[model samples]
Target: MSDSTDLPRFPQESSPGPTGPTGPTGPTGAAPTRPGTVNGAFWAFLAATVISIVSGLLVLGERDSLADAVRRSDAKLTAQQIDQAATVAMVAAVVIAVLIALLYLLFAVKLRAGRNWARIVLTVLTALQVLSLLAGSGGSWIGYLSCLAAVIGVVLSFLPESSAYFAAARPVRR
Candidate 1:
């Protein structure tokens, strides 16, 4: 008689068969839902960044006005000095605008990731922006629009839906 050991294991010895239903499945968590506020904030920040870049370009375009303003503020400044200062200011503004745009993007990403600190930081920055806009003499429409976008972003971040998402993301205490 053939020994049982001569035969391969049941499944291993058999030819491939039709696949059957798998075993019990693990719990699947609820589907992730991105809040509208987060999306709004992201777009608003992007808009603000574009507006800031445009405003910087506008400043460069009106270099003569900037130099004149500087001269009026400081009578001792010669034409050459005023021109130099205007150039410096334009360069500085461009650099600052780029940096601000990058900062806004970072904040938007962090905020979307449910970072409470990012939300707080963005709110503080928005408040500072609004304050600065209020304190300074207004210029181009771009500046006002940028400030408005910042304000909208801040508001959206504090909406009830946003708050709920943040709360959900927060770790629960024992």
Candidate 2:
């Protein structure tokens, strides 16, 4: 007679059933959708930057005695100072344009990717732009119109559609 302890045990699968320790179930939800506010803001920012750079370049290209005279009265700069200022302004404009373009691209990517931080960043940036437009006024025809256009752009960007989009993109509480 054989002992019970020597009897066969439960059969196991050849491949070893449940070979590893059990793991908890994964998160039970999908990620949210991207918003359009990011896209619109990105486009507007890029376009504004490009326009500013192009205009600056064109203005710098036209620098002559007329430009010097204009700068002398408008900026209280001497002839030599005007020349220096023009060069500085041109370089600054191009650099700023590139930087703004890069920022816009980053903003768009972050907004689309649902980074959440982009919403606050975009809001602050747009608000700063609005303030700049108001503070940079010079009462000149071109200056006034430029500022007005900026104001309009900023205002339109706050429309319901854009607002909703931005809200949706905001970070969620876990």
Best by lDDT: 1
| Global CA lDDT computed for model 1 | 0.76
Model 2: CA > 4 A from native: 1-29, 35-38, 65-85, 139-174
Query: Residue 38's C-alpha lDDT in candidate 1?
Result: 74
Say which candidate scores most in TM-score. Answer: 1
Candidate 2 weakest ten by summed lDDT:
17-26
- The CA lDDT of each predicted structure is 0.76, 0.52
- Native-vs-model 2 lDDT? 0.52
User: Tens digits of per-residue lDDT for model 1 on 36-106?
Assistant: 88789878877887888888777778888889889999999888999999999989988998898888889
